[model samples]
Target: MTDSLARMARRWWLALWLAALPALATAWMPVGDPAWPDPQLALVYVERTLKRSDDGLILSAHLALFRSSVYRLTVIDPGADAETPRPTLPESFQQAGSVAGVNGGFFHPDGQPLGLVIAQGRRINRFETTRLLSGVLYSDARGIHLQRRAHFQDQPGIDALVQSGPYLVEHGRAVRGLSTGDPSQRTFVATDWHGHWILGATRTRLTLADLAAALSTPGALTPWPVERAINLDGGSSSGFFFDRGPDVEPVVMRPWKPVRNLIGLTPR
Candidate 1:
């Protein structure tokens, strides 16, 4: 083959490989654990293999680690009116100027956010109690905080908040009594020991107990030890989105249905 023709073929192959790299990297499979000595805006994608008593499952999760000191966490609402079009995860991410995010609390059929929702220091909804909805995630100038609704205090200087439930982890341990056998897609928000935020979701179906175990188990898919975690809306409503940067297209696991609210992480 001529030198120029060979060079052109090489360039074409390189272009194809470059285009396919992100899709391949984001595919569901286990990945090596990453270490972050200093907190910053970073995302690690993992397809974790879980050890269940009945059978194993692959849990696709994106672990986004970011310092609360360097980023702002906020809740986004698409409004309560029925006429307003609900935004998908990617739309909410772009609209909120978020680097990473996940679907927020559960909502009613007409798209009204259930439980409490406070955005940018403004109260959007009041606290409500339900069987499964038990946790609240809020942020203040001090940083992000998670607690059960019964324990959460209405504090000053609060910036954003969302209430969702079935607390997955508390005080660094997995909360007990989660459904261990029923498998379904799941989404969760958590904080590591150092208070760095983590948003994750299973790409495939898995029981809630399995997910809690995976997040709380050290040396698991979760890169850091999870100090606290809570289950968000899952099943058809589960969604996750992360913006790698300007050069790469964002990783978006879209919801099967439109969502009413989202929790977004914006770089500070």
Candidate 2:
């Protein structure tokens, strides 16, 4: 070809590469896991006091069910704890290794329960499932189908019911350390079952009433119709602890740590 033609082709190729550079960068950038360290933690504590004591809200405290002295508080979106590393592991969890559950659920370096498992993505080569969020609750085998719409922006409430935390009941006992995916990643999942819906988040927290109020407005996070919802782990560990006893407000595990992802529940 002519010298000028060759030069023109080279320029075109360079231009094409430059144009694709931004997209490539975005693709390489990690999703779910925040650029900064934001870890979250959740725990199930028993409080005999009618009103639980609080030391300020850690994570985002939203009262779910306050009646019967059994209160459910949804905590979401908090900062990370320095001691923990990527893909945090829990000591209480049963380490089945790769063949067991998804990524290890969010946990303290010493192994603390954060949240339940919901959905996770599989690796391209090893096919390993990576946990996207720390504080979300996931469904059991029968509820596995709830993850069908796992990674979508618009989550169905029913599907979320299968993915949120409330203590995993297996063989009539609560099994601790259940993870669907990983600690290094996070995702937004939601579900709509009847009028009740469930919304999962990482870096987002809204009280049950606040979420209900948000749904009433014109513009909302999830476009689908939602009756009620609660906040889950939002930051790193993205976990919560509900305490209902003598004082007021429920006690949360990591009140300081920032959570990125969480799973919320609504009453029937």
Candidate 3:
């Protein structure tokens, strides 16, 4: 082939490869184990750059894995149900002395909970029946879990809980008809249904449909496929903080606005 023609062909192939990269997927791989120096610790942090199944947009994710047997997960809120503002996730994580933390459920413009919020065993807000309030993440005798609002039977003696979201994933698949147009940074919780759950978020902005699609995709959560997931209050309220130590750089996304509550982990 003529030199110029061969060069043109090579350029065309390069363009095609570049176009395909957006659709290329990456697996959730752990950066380091014990996420801390403790050899006995069970928290495993994982991350990946993956395409949104709904679209080819790329996003990076950070997830902290927790097994109820090894870690204590809690949902916390400032005491008052009125006119409350909160520190950013990183600061709050340090203050709470948790292994990691992410912003919690939705709230009204008046700064009141939109659904149920039981923090530290105190009922901060009563449960409400609403389409958006579809998932409840709480700690009961069985331990921390995610339950569909329709199925959650509130009895007695709960430790912490945060009711949130439109139920992103169910039965190991993304739910149909998640809103797709608006994109923003997201914080979410997902479970494997056997007491293994994840606290995760992406600084990369993504629509709910995109986030749900990514979560349900294989290798997104690593080791455990998502059985169910719930979206925490996102947009400017979305944030996450995982401090490995002063030596290791923490994974964090600071919220631009004051978050209503936090879901965090501590040693079991």
Candidate 4:
């Protein structure tokens, strides 16, 4: 072939590949041990291994990472009335068009959210604070923000909010004075420097302090730097779920009991 013709063909091939990149990145893939379903948003689903402080191992803990800019974060509140019926995570997931979710906040025995529960721009439950429940997770025009309850008050334009936590990580460091013993299944929500959100849970048991340490250490479990982290309701309430679409069955770690609220991720 002539030099000019060869150059033209190469240019055309490059242009075609560039145009196909978006579809290729977002296409569904096999749900193996670690899966990258969405490349453009940098979403991932994987099981990770971590060592406990007492020289034990946490094998196959479920972890997921989703960029805030790519996914909308919202909370699902069953209702404010204690007598109202509550739905399971799978039910809530399908209702909200959520791809993944985890249990949110603590609750009363009668099934009402114990602390503040805000959904769809309205406060459904009143705010309460104790030694363990001190932080609030809320979404507004600026995105999700986590702060101490003492410094936060109900404000306008909040899309969703759930109050829970001992503030696992603060100011890029693991918060001191967390429980070092009495390990149990745990779940947490954390934010990276880029404002991306991470929802993760331990299949194996780990105390509050050990969980924070793993998150703070670079490359310990998460690929991003967790600027702030907060513990959700763990123990019997700890669970994680991800809907991988029609082709692949959903991934779910069932909670021991029905939960009052959940935090979910919806595609933007």
Candidate 5:
């Protein structure tokens, strides 16, 4: 009888440990209704307008904690069908949802000269919010860190925000850099510049004060000067990508995994 009790206790403990494994192994993502194309990926839907005066497209991406460690890239396709189908990463990059060091993550298209230079190598994940903020600050080759500005009142009910580095305007103005803000609500903004400003958090969202500061300052850094930009889903649902040109095919950087929401940037 004593031996049987001990075995039962051991089994109970083992079951408890197994139940807690998921919570301990990964981060948390509280997305609404993520439009996941695959059971192992995550996705979000975003739609924004771009004014005719706006310049190039703005793409972004993020990872889903609970469903996957995969990243989903969002961009404006002027030629794609209205029904956008989710595509997987190249065979060389696709993983089994738990493997690491997969190829074909967030990257630029092949043979495309850098018109808008994107500096990679920085470590930005879903759990670490500051890393992404810091990535934007030192995105240039010079590696200049930015300051976090105070909150802006452009959007009300914002709880917190984070300012990137500084902006390099076309007129040589040192305007505030990019910012990620939160209005304590799920709000999505579509800009005329093909930029999408989404307000929601699967992990940590930015505030209004933070965005105002970055937008106000210009010429704050070196290399790939910030002309104009906007915020995205910072948590597990924030990501972007582009196909380089009209004729060029969609080179999957961060694949369109499952997401809670997305800020789709369509060309004007």
Candidate 6:
């Protein structure tokens, strides 16, 4: 009887310890849905480590969720070589007074934007009907949106917009034809369509198809399920920034090279 009791006790303790391991592992990284943002705050930063279902590879990701009603998304353009000294993402975020930002749009080798870019309610470039330029991230009187190039409408009074992509997610499913090879760093934007949007970047390198599959999976991003997502200018242009506040260190992932435009948030 004594031996049996001891064995039972050992088993119980072992189960308890095993149960605690996952919680202990994700200390800075939350396993479940993180705390929703305070109502008064416009944006909330989230950190998560997601394990891919097939290979069980871990993807460490950073995310920022902002309420659309309280914040207005903008394109912070450095302009057409108008200034001698130009700021990269970190410095641009500092100058614009934005809470969070990510690198935006694709550009040509000569530093010209590849597709439509609107800033401060003016068009910087016109739309291009290329096979790769398949989506648009823009804001208008109806609010922020990620629309397929097929469905997008050219509206007046559009203040902020960037056109770039090969859609990562459409109608909540990963687009089927994304390239599976050439893994690289990535940045993207997703929306729940219930007044919230997210900016995210992968610390781990992944193919576009893998990223699209991971994002379309549930529990990849917290507090809301994604309805739509569009890839931003990734690869070496994959930069991200979020200002936590004065007391906490801000989250910043610098791009490998200089980028032409940035998508950022401003308190309305």
- The most accurate candidate by TM-score is 6
C-alpha lDDT of all candidate models, in order: 0.76, 0.29, 0.77, 0.78, 0.27, 0.81
For every model shown, what is its TM-score relative to the native structure? 0.80, 0.25, 0.79, 0.80, 0.22, 0.83
* lDDT of model number 1: 0.76
Candidate with top lDDT is 6
Better of 1 and 5 by lDDT: 1
Cα lDDT, model 4, residue 229: 92
Which structure is stronger by TM-score: 1 or 5?
Answer: 1
User: Candidate 6: which stretches are off by over 4 Å?
Assistant: 1-41, 80-83
Provide the lDDT at 99 for model 6. Answer: 85
Question: Which stretches in model 2 have alpha-carbon errors above 4 Å?
Answer: 1-109, 114-137, 140-189, 194-209, 216-219, 235-268
Count of backbone clashes, every candidate in sequence: 0, 68, 0, 0, 44, 0
lDDT of 1 at 206: 79
Model 5: per-residue Cα lDDT over 1-268, one tens digit each: 6999999999999999999875344322212432333322233322221111122211122222111122312221111232555444322122222111111112113312111111122122221223333212111221122223232222222211222222222222223443344332111111112222112121223333333322223211111123343333333323333223456553333423333222222211
Full-model lDDT, candidate 3 = 0.77
Please report, as a residue range, the 10-residue window in candidate 1 with the lowest summed lDDT: 25-34
- For 13-114, candidate 2 gives per-residue lDDT tens digits of 999999987534323111232222111111122111011122121122222212212212122221244465523222111121110111223444434334
Instruction: Give candidate 2's error at residue 146 in angstroms.
Output: 8.8
In model 1, pairs of residues that clash are none
Candidate 4, residues 111-162: lDDT per residue as tens digits?
A: 7777778876667768786777789988877777888889897778888898
What's the TM for model 6?
0.83
What is the C-alpha local distance difference test score of candidate 6? 0.81
